[model samples]
Every structure is written in structure tokens, then in C-alpha cells.
Target: MSQSPAPARRRRGNARGEQTRSVLLAAAVRAFADRGFHGTSTRDIALAADMSPAVMYAHYATKEDLLFELSLDGHRSVQVLLDAEVGRHASNTDRLRAAASCFGQWHAEFHTQARVVQYELNALTAEHLAEVTVLRRAIQGLFGDLIRAGVDEGVFQVADAEMTAMSLTSLGIDVARWYRPTGAWTPEQIGHHHGRLALRAVGVAD
Candidate 1:
């Protein structure tokens, strides 16, 4: 009788596959960050991954697939981080402080991926764009919730919670565009500063 493959062998194959996909993703983020999505090609990503075009194709059917994956992962990761950060504090002031710091520092730490996530949405197919949009909206909603909470508690004075939320998010997202490790401020410093600024922006004394 024929038998199925060993569990260990299948596990090894799965691990290898995941590893390859990770390498490809790193390479893609770098490429897309340096060269916008339209300017990038599968061959470029394959070379950056140090793998052949065929291997890259085996993992990602199209360049858009890689981008969609990156965007989805980036947005989801940010949302989760913000959620955890905000949940850690009892007060809206503390929650905004943590959330802004986390958001800003994350962009500096993963600026390449952040850049692609923020700047490459136009290149995605409509179906992919719609999917990515849902994740983006969820992230925005997190910030909106925090701003609204602050307003409700009389901790934050803002004209419009929704617009204030968008502005707050933009402050962190823009960091990815120009953040450099060699800069005077480290990621932590930037984060701390952003935390203070966020409070001040929300009309809190900080």
C-alpha cells in the first residue's frame, strides 16, 4: 500500500517555503522602497532576493501579489501594534502617547516596508486595492477611536475627531519618507518626541 510522506519531511518543506517567501518579501520591500512599484519588475525583485526569476515566480505569481502581500502584512501589523499599545494604558492621554510613539518608531524601524505600504497603493489592482483598503481603514479607525476617546473624556480638544485622527496618522507615516538611522535622533528618541507632539496636537499639556 502507498503511504503519505513523513510529517518531518513535510514540515521541512513548509519551513523552507516560508523562508524563501520571507527573503523575497524583504527584497521586494527594498526594491519597492527605492524604486516605486511601477518602476520595479519581477526580475528586479528576483535579483534582489538572490534567486532566479523562476523561483520568485514559483512563490509569487505576479509582482502585484508580492505588493498586495506586503501592504496587507504592513497594515495588519500596525493595527495590531496600535491595539496592544493603546490597550496597555487606562487613560486616553496615556493611550495616545503610547500609540503615537509606537506608530512613529515602527515607521522608522521598518521604513522600507512602511514606504511601500504608504506609497504603492496606486499600483495595486482594483480587487487588491479593495482588500488593502479594508485593512487601511481598520488602522485609521484605531487612531480615530483614540482621538474620539480623548475628546469624550475632556482630555483632548479637537475640532473634528476624524480629521485629527488622519493628521495624527500622517505625522507617523511621513517619518518613513525621510527617517535615517544616521540622523541625530534614534528611533526611540523620535518616538518619544512624537508622543509629546501628539499630546500637544490634541490640546493636552503633555
Candidate 2:
């Protein structure tokens, strides 16, 4: 005998499940960004996502897991953007500017995710935090190396290569906190503005 056709209700439930998962993730990003990992609850996230707490838990096992996922995803995005920028251009100055621009633009566009990833990182467990730290350091080192390259080429001047890299990263990272899409400047404009400022921070002329 032939098998019976699949139930329409089952397919609809699967589609709804996927949609709920997306909403929960987005809401978790915002809630965790505004409130620390410990401050947020499954109910808060569920309400923000327009789903019930049961639905939220259906997708995420715990608040810590959500935070871990967000942090991991954010770090991966930063790494990919920085790596692509470094690979795309040969000049150290250009590479550095591209990296800064990419970072700034990303922060502007994904401010909630950036903020959640940056501010709530401490909430992660030791092992998870350590893994995230490695990714963070690698991204920082990429910029540090680019700064060092600029200094060696005499295209940029800096008091300290490592410190300058930190400063540059801070400049981009803080954009997520203050940037507003509805404000006067667009992400590209903000990125370019900061990129130029970063160039000057290393003693490059306008």
C-alpha cells in the first residue's frame, strides 16, 4: 500500500517554527543588548519576539546559549570582514582604512548585535569566553599588524603600535553605541568619517 500524504498542518507548523526562531533571535539580540545577560529573561525575549516563553525555549535551551551564539556570530562576522579587507588591498594604509570602514559600517548596521556581543561578553562561561577571546584577539591582531606595516612603510606614525590598534578598534566599536540610522549621517558616511579620523590618529595626513 502507498504511504499517506504528509499532513498540511505539519508543514505549516515547521514554517511557523522557523519564523518564531528568527524572531526570537532578533529579539534576544535587542533585549540582551539593552539588558545584561543576567538581567534578561525568557519572558522578556519572548514578549519582544511576540512569542510565548515556551516558543522561545523551544528554539534556545537557555539564556547563556543565546548569548554564546550571538557572541560567536558577531566575532565571526568581524573576522570575515577584516580578513576580506586585508586580502583585498595591498597597501597597509588602504587595508587599515578598509578594515576600519568595514567595522564601522557593520556596527552602524547591526548596532544591537554589536552592543550585545561587546557588552554582554562577560556573561559567558569561562570556556566560552575564552573561545570568544581568541577570535577577538585575532581580529585585533589583524589591525595591529596593519598599523605596524604603516609605521614600517613610514606612511603612518604612532607612539605605540599596539595602543594605536586598540584606539582604532575602539573608535569603530563605539559607533554601535551612539550611531542612529535616522540621524544625519548614513553608515557609509559614518564609516568614511571615522576611517579618515583613524588615519589621522596614526599621523596620516588628510
Candidate 3:
């Protein structure tokens, strides 16, 4: 027999718990991005979320858990974009453009989270750092494959696939550090601009 579903109150509680977790995550991302992980405290995160420290603790076991969640989330987002773009595009040049645009757009929109993931990763424990490092490597591998495809297809002329990928990733990731939404360019515009720049960097004719 099928077991009964959770009670209404229990379901509501679960939803509320998820909402609280998201709030804490956003708060933690902002705090860590602004204050550095070593400087930000649980109370600071709680106040940023407009929730008490006890409430924040109810959702996350520790600050390390929050950092891990943010790191994993950022890595997963990049991986998702890479998987979708690579699966959908056929032309090597188009694949590279799609990947670069998607990456740039993500950094522009989620600058705070991106900054935390990129800069504050060193604050995690060795075990957590190892896990995050693996995820980061997987994301880099996707881009490296795209670079190799571009070279193999003769669409791009590059000296080294690994170095080219690193340069491309850095170009996109650095947008998070200085990009401003109120600036002259929208995220889409910035993505397109950087997409062209990335193509040019790899010797793809515009």
C-alpha cells in the first residue's frame, strides 16, 4: 500500500524551512562577498537576512555549511549552462559563443554569489575545498573541450587549449568583480560584447 503523504502542516513547515534556507544563503553570500568569510559571523548573516541567529542556525548547521552550499550552487549553475549549450549547438564556433555568453550573463546577474564562490573558496575546510575543487575542475573541463572542438574544427586558431580556456573563463568571471547593473550595458549586451571578444581572442573571425 502507498504510504500517506506528509500532513499539510508538515508540508508548510518544510516550505518555510526552504524559504529560510534560501534567505540565509543569499545573506551569507552578501556577507561573505563584502566582509570575507573569516570576517563574517553567523550573527552577521542572521541580521542581514532579518532573522535571528537562532533561526539561521535552525537552517544551517554551521557557517561552513553555508559556504559549501554557495560554492556548490555556483558550480552547478555553470555546469548546467555548459551542458545545455554544448548539447544544443552543432557548430564549434556557435558552441563557443553560447558557452561564453551564458557564462558572462551568469556572472553579471549573480555577481555576489559568483564573487563569493571565486574569492572566498579558500575559507572552507580541506575536505570541503577538495569537493569544491572537483566541481570547479569539471566546469573547466567542459570549456576545455569546447576550445579543443574549436581548434579541431578549424573555426578557431589557438596556441594552447588549456591556456585559452583559462583566459576565456577569467574574462567572463572578472565581470562579476566590476560589472554594474546600472551601467550603460545590460547583462545581455555585456554578454554579447564579451562573446565577440572571446571569439576574437581565440582567432575566430567575427
Candidate 4:
């Protein structure tokens, strides 16, 4: 059966509202990434989006509310991207490699929003934190399951599949912290390298 949407997913009620909401989200990403969630205010977000407080409040209830929305959307995105990439391969190692690569690529490409999602969890309300954790765990489980499958098949030598999965997941999320578009490595290169590193981390030999 299909699951229902969360309250966070029910905000945009019409085409125009959705467009306004999108604008706010984009502005929030930049503001949060540059100044951080705690440092940026609703006014900062509204000014960046070129909207008044009344207009911004009409779209998002508060600063924390905007952060929650971004967190929810970003957390869901990693799972979707990871699952899609992992699903393309039959072997467990292959799946892990793809997941790691795609995870890295996404972190690099969407580093601003990703940085906010990864590094700003403390700013979210307790209720919002719990909501985002569901998606976060699901993404972690996808990678962990692949590691466990490889271990079962004697294809990996990890002492703990879940712990190893956590390490690999961090490998991707950390990229957004220091990665720059003008840097020597491109997102795809980072993605490919991360994939190989993940495979090696699990004892995939040459």
C-alpha cells in the first residue's frame, strides 16, 4: 500500500504557492549554507527571495519550519538517488559502489543544500528531527543491506556491516563540507573515486 505524505509535505496548495515555496527553499539553501541555519533568520531568507516577511510567513511558518522542509526534502533525495543507483546492479559490491558514487556526486552537485541537511540537524525541532531520521535511516539501511549481502557471500570482510555502512555514508556527506566547483576534482570524478574507495573499504581486492 502507498503511504501518505507527512505534514511537511502538505504546504504548497497551488501552482503559485508551489512556485513561491520553491523560491523560498532555494534562497534558504544558499543562506543556510553560507551563514548556517542558526546564523540565518527568516528575514535573511525573505530578503534573499525578494519577498516580505508576510509573504514568506505565508509560505513557511518560521525559520525552523523552512529548515525542516529543506531537511525533509534533502533526506528523502539521498534515499531516492542511492536506491536508484544501487538498483541498477545485481552484485552486492556493485550496488554499494553505485550507491557510494551517486551519493558523492549528489553531495558535490548539491553541496549547499546538502551542507545544511548534514551539518544543521541541531537547529531542527525535536519533532522535525524525528521526521527526518526516518528517511536518513532508510538511506543508511540501503547501503548497510548491500554490505551485509556481500559479507554473506564472502565478498566483503567488514566486521560490522552497519558500522561500515555508516563510514561509507559519511564519506559522501563530508564531501559537501569542503568541495568547491572550481576545485581540481569534478563531482563525477569525486563520485567515481568514492565508489572505488567504498569497494576497497569492504575488502574488494584488485
Candidate 5:
């Protein structure tokens, strides 16, 4: 029947749509990072991606939607990275160190992307920022939980696990602001330094 082919056609169309959406998001991240959300326009993103502004509008209603998508996706990625690393390690110290290292490395590796995602949230709609904050909290909780576990296991000696976690997370979050690929330190090196510092922040001695 003709109706049977409709579902298959829809599936193919959806796949193509998703691919286009991905390209738009990628372009938006670069534009937002280089120009900031307030400076980037729908036409700017379209030009950067080599697509028509109409195409971008087809995928997103406005520039804010594009920025929101990038922010949410980037934050989700950080959470996924932490979750994967957390499950691979047994000891609290190893897990905590790995989390810090992972976050730092990612921030550096995707500095442009991180810059827009971390710094451009002020441009998001109030509702959108609230949605993004949920992911931010999850990321913070990931660090907090590991620090607490380390404290309970006697592997760490922090007075307050929560504040220590924030300090540790800051090491990497701040990297997005100042990290340069041509800098004195490589992403891996930065990761290692921050990981060790995080351990120390939690009172890990050695």
C-alpha cells in the first residue's frame, strides 16, 4: 500500500533532518564562541555553515533556540563523560582524580565549544537557562559524590566535601576561558595538573 512507504520515507527524512541539525549546531557553537551569542545572528550561522538562512530557520525558530541546543548538548556531553569515567574506577581517589582530569581535558579539547556553552548561557531564555542548570547540577553532583566517598573511605580529608568539589570543578571550568592550544601546557598536561590539584583540594596527600 502507499501508506506503508510513508513510514519509511518519514524515517529517511528524519535522518536527513537530524544531519542538517547537527551541522547547524556545530556552526552555531563556533559563531557564538567567536562573536558571543549577543553578536551572532541567524544569517551569520547560515553563512558559517554554508547553508541558507532559511535552512537554519527550518531547523530552529530563532538564534536563541540554536544557542540553547548547543548549551544543552554540551552540558549533556560533560555529564556523559563523567558518568563513563566514574563507572570505570573502583577507589574513590582514582575516580575523583579521573573525573577532574576528564573534565579538564574535555574543556581544553573543546575550548571553543566550551567557551560558548559555559559563557553564553546568559543569553539563553530564563526557561532555557533553568533547563540547562539541571545538567550543570548533575555535573557538580558527580564531583561532590566522589569527594564524599573519598572522605568516607578515609582516602581524603576535606572539611566540606561540597565546597571542595566546587573548587576542584572550577579548575577545569576556568580553563575554557583561558586555554589556548599554543599555550605552555597541552590539554593532557593541564588535565594531569588539575586532577592532582583536585585530589589535593580534597586533602589527598602524596
Candidate 6:
């Protein structure tokens, strides 16, 4: 299947209201990424969104609520992307290449949101964390399945499919930590680079 652009998070009904919610979410992503969730206040997010705290509250009941939505969207975006990519290719190597490339590129393109999603798990309510963990596990499962398929094909020599899958995921997710638009590589370039690296990581020559 062809990929769809990541959908904007929707809530509270109506186009205008949804627009406001999206704006607030973007602001919250910036704040949480810049100042760590515990260090940033709702007022900071509201101000960043050019709204009063009360208006921000109207959209999100709590700061953690905003984080939950962001985290949920971020994880869901990755899962949907990986699912589509995994389905598009028949061979295990092709699946791994597409998954690793898109995963790395996503982190680079949406670094701020990715940063919050990757690092703010501790700040989410336990209930919210559980929900996000489900998505995380589904994503990890895709990588594990791909690695196992490669091993079964005699194309990958990993001793532990699960551990190799996690390491591959870590390589992609870590892109959000240090990526800069000013850097030499574009997201697509970095993504393909990661794709080649992933092939090697799985014991396939690029």
C-alpha cells in the first residue's frame, strides 16, 4: 500500500476547534522537547501558542493530557508507516530496508515531536503510558518479525532476533536526538544511509 501523510490529531469536534487543538499540540511538543515535561508549565505552552492558560485548558485538561495526545500520535504515526512499508514488500531484506529508512527519516523530519514522544514516557500518567506502550510493542513486533524472517531465509545471522530488532529501532530513534536541518544530509539521505546500515546490521552486505 502507498503511504498516507500522518493525520493530524483530532478532538473536540469542528474544523476550527480541531485547528486550535493542533496548534496547541504543536506548541506543547516544542515546550516539552525544550524544557523536559516536568520543567515546563501549561502556561508556557499556552504562551507559546499565543493563548491564555484558560483557553489552552479548554483544549487539554492538563499538560500531561497534551503529552499523551502527542505521544499517542507520534507512536501511531510510526506504527502506521511501518505497517504499510512492511506490507508493501515481500522479501525480508526489502521490508527491513523500508522500515529502517522510513523510521530514521521520520525522526529527522519530526524531531521535536519525536523527541517528546521518545523521551516523555515518564511524564505520562500510568494509564496513558499503558496505551502508548501497546503501540510501542506493536512497532517493535514488526521489526522482530522482519528480523526473524531474514534469519529464516538464511539472509540474517543475528543470534537474538529480539535484541537485534531493538538495536535497529534504537538506531532510528536516536536520529531525533541529534539531527539538525543544517547538517549535510537530508532526511531522505540519512534514511537511506540507515537503510544500508540496517542491512549490514542484519548480516547482509549492502
Across residues 1-206, which tens digit of lDDT does each residue of candidate 5 receive?
00000010111357789778878888988888888888888999999989999998888899998877778777887887788877898888889988998899888888888888888888999999999999888899989999888888888898898988788777789899999999999888988888898887877764
lDDT leader: 6
- What residue runs in model 5 are displaced by over 4 Å at the alpha carbon? 1-13
Output the better candidate (4/6) by TM-score: 6
Q: TM-score each candidate.
A: 0.91, 0.85, 0.89, 0.94, 0.91, 0.94
Instruction: Give me the runs in candidate 3 sitting further than 4 Å from their true place.
Output: 1-13
Question: Where does the lowest 10-residue lDDT sum fall in candidate 5?
Answer: 1-10
lDDT by residue (39-116, candidate 2, tens digit) is 899889989988788877777888787787778878887887678766988888788888888878888878778888
Candidate 4 residue-wise lDDT, 67-167, digit = tens: 89888888777776676678789988888888889888888888888899899999989998998888888888888988999999999998999999999
Candidates 3 and 6 compared by TM-score, better number: 6
Once fitted onto the true fold, the runs of candidate 2 whose alpha carbons sit more than 4 angstroms away are: 1-20
Clashing pairs in 6: none
lDDT per residue, candidate 1, 75-159, as tens digits? 7778777887888899899999998898888888877888898988999999989988997788778888988988998889999
What shift in Å separates residue 172 of candidate 5 from its native position after superposition?
0.9
Enumerate residue pairs that collide in model 3. none
Give the CA lDDT, 0 to 100, for residue 177 in model 1: 91
Q: Which residue window of length 10 is worst by lDDT in model 6? A: 1-10
Report lDDT per candidate.
0.84, 0.80, 0.81, 0.86, 0.82, 0.88
